[model samples]
Every structure is written in structure tokens, then in C-alpha cells.
Target: MALARQLFNRRMMWMLLGCLVVFGGIFGFKFFGRYMMNQFMDNMSLPPATVTTAPVEQQRWQTRLSAVGSMRAINGVNVTTQAQGEVKAIYFESGQFVDKGALLAELSALPETAQIEVLEAERRLAERDFKRISALYKKGVATLRELDQAQATQDQVLANLAVQRATISERSITAPFSGQLGIRQVDLGQNVAPGDPVVSLQQLHPIYVDFSLSEQDFSRVKEGQGVELTAAAIPGQNFSGRITAIDPSIDPANRTFLLQATLQNPERKLRPGMFADVAVKVEKFRSVLVVPRTAISFAPYGNAVFIVRPAKSALAESTNNKAVAPSAQAPQWIAVKRFVKTGEERGDLIEIIEGVREGEQVATSGLLKLRNEGGVIINNTSPLPENLNPTPDNS
Candidate 1:
């Protein structure tokens, strides 16, 4: 019995020691996990993000009505032949500038020239006969009927001569107006018919641009309103002109009115059929709150901007800690995302209608790394552009 009691006591003591070790291990693991979590939380505090910012401004913005337009020459037409004949000579080269009534081409006028010569000879003989008859009639040698007959014969010959000359003129093609000619459509020895296109001519100086605006804007627009034009074909250049004409009636099919503007093209750089963007200065300037377009974070749900301000949490911590001087430590700023109402957009700036005030600085760059209440540092060494009218670099 003594031996058994001793053995039982030994077994109980071993079991008790094993249970204490298991419980101690479980509690120790739980404490260690808690400690690790605290360390991770401390490490998760992120540093401030560097960003560029700009202050919201109040600017005088002019109202403008915009539309797409097409350019046209003041005078454009296709020069054609007036009579049918074989082309004998081409006087002008392709793409040449010619004056009005300048000869372009000449058809084979050999037959017509021969006929004119014959008619002239007949006219000369008839004139001499008429003179002789008139002289005799005055002297009473020739009768009145003979003088009248001779006079009639001379008039007939003169009429025939004029008709032959007109036929020759019809065979010669000339420029109807002063302009530049396009590619020549005919060559030497090529037969052409009447009304067939010979070449295209266009008076390029003082070009016209035709555009349309909504009928609602008809009352707001008038002749002499200033217009600014930019074309995709000619970038970085703007042409200015004034409205020259407006359609009297609106198109019933589209409810739009046509507007025409005249621009001087002394260089002839603006060509017909080129597409252009037109902006008509419609109203006087008005003051409005504006911001750089880059500052806004556009979203389908709502548009927002990050307004920078002092971080309250950091300020409180600094206040509590007397050892850390406010001046010694770098200033802390936080980006607070605020929804905004935007109005019309100009070149690089946008009108802010609501949710922001003038003189408040908003983050312009590094927006993708930003979040609400996130830490930020303002670094405006390289700021984004905010021009009202931005131009492309020639390079």
C-alpha cells in the first residue's frame, strides 16, 4: 500500500506540472500575438505625401459661344471651256496665279482663222465697190437703186466678218477672274467639249468661314461680333475676325442658324474645306471663383478636390509633448477631400461654383496617392500650369 500511494502521488504531480505548462503556453502565445499587433499598428503610420498646390482664384471670365465650322474661299469655281475643239496650245502651267482675262488655253482655231481671212477680203472688195457707186450716184452717173444695192452688199460682208471673228474668240479659253489655278485637266492635242472642266480657280485672300449656332443664340449674335478661330490643320495659331453675315431664317430641320465670318488670308495659309473651331465672344466679363483643372478629381458620382489644412491630430500631439518644439518639427498638413460643383471649363482652369472658397489652396499634383484625412506636405517648387489660353509648343 505504501508503494502504490507513492507511485500515485508521483503520477498526480507530473500531470499537474504538465497542465500548468499547457496553460502557461496558451497565455504566453496570446500575449505575444497582442504585442506583435501593437508593433504593426505603430509601423503602419504612413509618412506625409509630397504634393503641389495652387490657391483658388477669383477671375474675370468672358462668356463665349463655341461651334465647329468649315473654311471657304471668297470666290471659288471650276474654269471650263466655252466651245468644242482640239486643244492646240496650253499657255498656263498647273497651280499658277493668273489675272482676269488671261489666256489659259487655245483650241485649234486654224479653220476659223482661214474663214475670217476670206470674209475680210470680201468685205474690202465690197467697201471699194460701195464707194465707187456712191461717188457715181452723187455725180449722177449711177442710179439711186445701184447705190442702195452696193451699200447693202457692203453691210452684209461686214456682218459676216464679225460672225467669223466671234467664232475664233469662242475657241480661246481665258481666266474669268483673278485667282490661283489648280491642276490642269487638259493637255495639248486633247479634244474638249463645251462646259467640260478645264481647271479649278479659287480666290484665297480674304477667306470666309461658315459655321452654325443654335437658334436660341440668334438674338445674342449679330454682325461685327468678334470671333476667334483655331484649326486642327494649323495648330498653335489663332485667326481673329468679325461676324460678317447671319442667316435671316433658321433651318427648320435642325433648328440652327448659319453665321459667316471673314478673315484675311494674305499668306493664303487657310485653305477651303479645312475644319475649324470657332469661339464668339458673346457677353461682358464676369467675376467667378476658379481653380486649376488638374486639382479636380472627376467622378461619375461626384467631383471632388483635396483641400490642404493643418492636421488636428498632429497638432494635439505636439501640444501635449513639451519636449518637442513646434518650430523644430516639420509642419503637418492633411488633405481633406471635398465635393465641388464645377461650371464651364476654360483652357487650363475651371470655374468652381460651390464647396470651395477663394484663396484656399487645393492639391494639384500627386492626387492618385491622396486620401481623405491623409497626411500631406506642400511642395510648390514645380507647379502645374493654369493659363486661360494654353498654346502648344512648336517643338
Candidate 2:
């Protein structure tokens, strides 16, 4: 019985030992799998990102003040009639160019023309009687009063004729100035009253552009300052002119002052009331650092840019150590994010006031995928546009 009991104990002990080995193997396998995964992840590296880059450039930039404006003719008016009468004849066609004093229309004047003939006949009769009275007065056969009466009648008749001629002249309508005419408002035989619109006349050549500027810019502007203009109606065309006039008083509501610029419209393409974009060259040219606008990464906190440089060089600079020795492999490039201070923008380029030096390469595309100190492969085959004055591409 003692031997059997001892054998049972040993069997139980062996079973327990087998159970411990199986559980230990399972736990160790799990821990080994987890350790292998962490090692693989730590050694792995992301693929280099493809990006486009542009070099920082220093150039002379003109300082300009911009504003919206409207085009106007130097002389524009709504032509109207001065006399009340029926239009007997319409001499001018719609949109015809005319000179000063050129007849535009004529009113019906038959009554006034007929009255002149009667006055002339009456004057002839008065002159004959005055001659007979004068002959009698010289022979002492007529009273002085008789001679005076004859002379008075002749003078009265002459005055009546002069009044009739003046009345006939008012029936004619003529151009007040040399300009192009708009659509005709009066038709033939249409009765028109005084102050009624006849047509519109505008002197389009050497047109004026009316714009306003802030009162703060008042001192920077003066008569004869150069201005450049562009209109959406006529795209891709630039018009140059000079400031011709400036309002002495500032607008109380907006605190802006009015300015008028004169530009020659030889093609007559610029019409009155056209909306225009005006840029006044306010200051002399000065040197400034510029970069492609796409290079900037705008954020609510601040603006930033990714500067591309040799990976070894960047790492060494960050560590404040000397550059690593050159390797046999090709040089690796990396993107380093940098905060920047920006100024006014022109076209697709923006002025960089701080953070980057001239000639340093900056990433212009693929900014979203880039990380600080990340590897980059430059592919400028499809470079972004960097025009100083960009325009729409309808094609």
C-alpha cells in the first residue's frame, strides 16, 4: 500500500510539471511574436515623397496701391433739344460721329419762314413813303412832323424783319461738340418739347477712369503719377495713364478721395461705365525677397514653408555638429519646415519678409504629404506656375 501511494504521488507531480511547461511555452510564444512586431516597426522607413521646388529670388519690386475704378468718357452728355417743335427732318443717324455745329436735326419752321417775306414787303413800302416825305421836306412843302412819321415807320418795319429772321434760326438743331452719337430718341415728324432728350453724345478718345483711394494714400498720390489699369470686359489688355485730377476733400462717409486718370483709347474699345482694376505705382522700385505663393503653408496660427536641403547637412545643423563625411551613395534631400513672415502678394508670388534666404530651394508642391525632416525627391517635370502677372487661361 505504501509503494502504490508513493507511485501515485510521483505521477501527480509529473502531470503538474507537464502542465507548467505547456503554459510557459504558450506565454513565451506570444511575447516573442509581440517583440518581433515592435522590432520590425521600429526599423521600417517611409518612402521618400515626390515634390516640386522653387528657389528664393531677390528682385526689384514696385510698390503699388490697388483700387477698383470705372471708365468714363472725358466728355459725356445726354443731348437734348432746346426748342419745342415738330421734328421735320432727322439728319443724324444713331452712332454717327459729328463735329461741332454740325446740323443734327431741324424743326418745322414754315410759319416763321413765311412771316419773313411779309416783313420784307412792308419795309419796301415804308422806304418809298420815307423818300417822298424827304423830297417834300427839302422843298419846304412838308411839316417836320410829317418827315419824322415817315422815318419812324421805315425803322419799325426794318426791326420787324430782323425779329423774323432770328425766330427762324431757332428751329435748327446742331451738335454742341465733336463726339460720337448714341441711339436716336426722336423720330421724323415727332413733336419734341424743350429739354427733351434727343440722343447721347460721348467723346470716347482719351477717356477718363474714376477711382477712389483711402485718405491715408492721399499724400502718396499726386497729379501726373503713373497708373496701370485692367478691365474684365477686355481681358489680357493693360492700359496705362496718368492721374489727371484729385478731389480736394475726402469723402466723409468712406474716408476716401476721388481720383481721375486719363488714358488714350485709340481703338475705342474702352467704353463709359466699364469696371476697371487700377494700380498706382506709388513708390520707387526696391529690392525684395520673393517666393512662389504655393511654397507657403498657411495656417491659423501662422504661415510656414518647407525648405529642401541635403539630409546629412540638415541633420548635422540640427545637432549643431559638423557635416557627416560624404558617402558613395547619391546625396539624400530632405524637407525642413520653417515658420515665415510674409508681406504683400503679387500674382502667383508672395513677398517673404523673413525666415528664408535668397537662393534657398523651397518646396512648391506636395506640401501636404511632407513632414519635418522627411526625405524628398524633387521632380520639377511639372513645375507650378510662377508668373509675376498671371492671367486666366481660357484655352
lDDT for residue 171 in candidate 2, whole number 0-100: 78
Please report the candidate that would top lDDT against the real structure. 2
**What ranges in model 2 sit over 4 Å off?**
1-51, 126-163, 293-306, 313-331, 335-342, 365-376, 380-395
Q: How many backbone clashes does candidate 1 have?
A: 0
Return the lDDT, model 2, position 173.
81
> Could you give candidate 1's per-residue lDDT for residues 1-395 as a string of tens digits?
99999999999999999999999999999999999998776545566799999999999878889999999999999999888899999999898999999999899988889988898899999999999999999999999999999999999999998888888898888998898999999998998999989899999989999999999999999999999999999876788999999989999999999999999888888999999999999877888999999999999999999988887753453423423223334548978888999998878999999989899889999999997666799999889998877888768
Steric clash pairs (candidate 2): none
| C-alpha local distance difference test of each model | 0.89, 0.90
| Top of the candidates by TM-score | 1
Candidate 1, run of 10 with poorest lDDT: 319-328
Root mean square deviation (Cα) for candidate 1: 7.4
Give the alpha carbon lDDT tens digit for every residue of 61-95 in model 2. Answer: 88899999999998899888777889999889999
Q: Identify the runs in model 1 with alpha carbons over 4 angstroms from their true place.
A: 1-43, 141-149, 300-302, 313-331
Clash counts for all predictions: 0, 0
